[model samples]
Target: MSDAPREIEALIEMMAKLPGLGPRSARRAVLHLIKKRGLLMNPLAEAMQAVAQTARECLNCGNISTGDVCPICTSEKRANGELCVVEDVADLWAMERSNVFKGRYHVLGGTLSALDAVGPDELRIPKLIDRVTSEGITEVILALNATIDGQTTAHYIADQLDGRVNVTSLAQGVPIGGELDYLDDGTITAALRARKSL
Candidate 1:
């Protein structure tokens, strides 16, 4: 049992549930918060509370938002003919960080998983199809991860929108600075298949 009080122990346990945080790390974080209660803990708590109260899914694209629509969905400048489809909000945020894709986004929330019984209805796939027609999207870019389930989901989406719109996918191969010797068999195969002529 921990020597800390019940409240502090509870806090540590709660923090331990966060991604990438173990019990020991949570304990250290809790202790740090206690040490900087006035300067850090109060603001952190306030911010968490604000987010908890205001956070909601965007009605249009399934992105997280405080209002019915996310800023990206509402912005007129993002209304290009291209629509990028991602597996989650984190993927959408990553794309935004790159600043390469100027068009709007559609978050599918997760990939299809037959083992887990997740299907098209479980994701935002239907909404994606509706948006393709309603928003006058000319191109649908599948930005899913290069996993089995991600590939399955991408294929399903492509088949669904086969004749309706042009479909494309993010290229999968080697990283920018990655060494060929360090890459695995799959990476080498994919890179060889996607090889470009100089």
Candidate 2:
């Protein structure tokens, strides 16, 4: 039996289920939190509770927001006639971290996955098309991952918006310091296809 109290062990088990954390890591984390209960644990618990109560998906863009519409969708400065489509809120957040794109976003929730029985109707694809029409979006940038499912979703979205708006995708490429020898054939081919003049 676990030496930890029932509640603490339960917390550790739940934490272990989180991405990137295993049982050992979760145990360490729980110990650290217990040690810093007054400073870290209480505040974290309160914050998580607050977010759990208020966090909701944006009605317009499918982004996680405390309000019905996320701040990005409501911001006047972000209405730049461009929409970046991503497979999930995590991907959207990654793009936001770059701070390069000055447009709004459409979180698809997930890519169309035949294996998992995911379809366009299951995602926010219909809402994306509606947004393109209603928001006067002139360009749709597909910033999906390079996985097969991601590519399939991108192609499907492009076809759906064929004549409506300019559809583009993030360039597939070799990383800044990547060695060609270490790359896969698909990466090399994609890089060659996306080659540009110096």
Q: lDDT values of the candidates?
A: 0.97, 0.96
Cα lDDT tens digits, model 2, 1-198, are 869999999999999999999999999999999999999999999999999999999999989999999999999999999999999999999999988999999999999999999999999999999999999999999999999999999999999999999999998889889999999999999899989999
Q: Pick out the ten consecutive residues of candidate 1 with the lowest summed lDDT.
A: 1-10
Q: Provide the lowest-lDDT 10-residue window in model 2.
A: 1-10
Residue 143 miss distance in model 2 (angstroms):
0.7
Clashes of each: 0, 0
Candidate 1: residue 23 lDDT (0-100): 96
TM-score of each: 0.98, 0.95
Model 2 steric clash pairs: none
Off by over 4 Å in 2: none
Per-residue lDDT, model 1, residue 145, is 95
Q: How large is the C-alpha RMSD of every model relative to the true structure?
A: 0.9, 1.2
Evaluated at residue 118, the lDDT of candidate 2 is 97
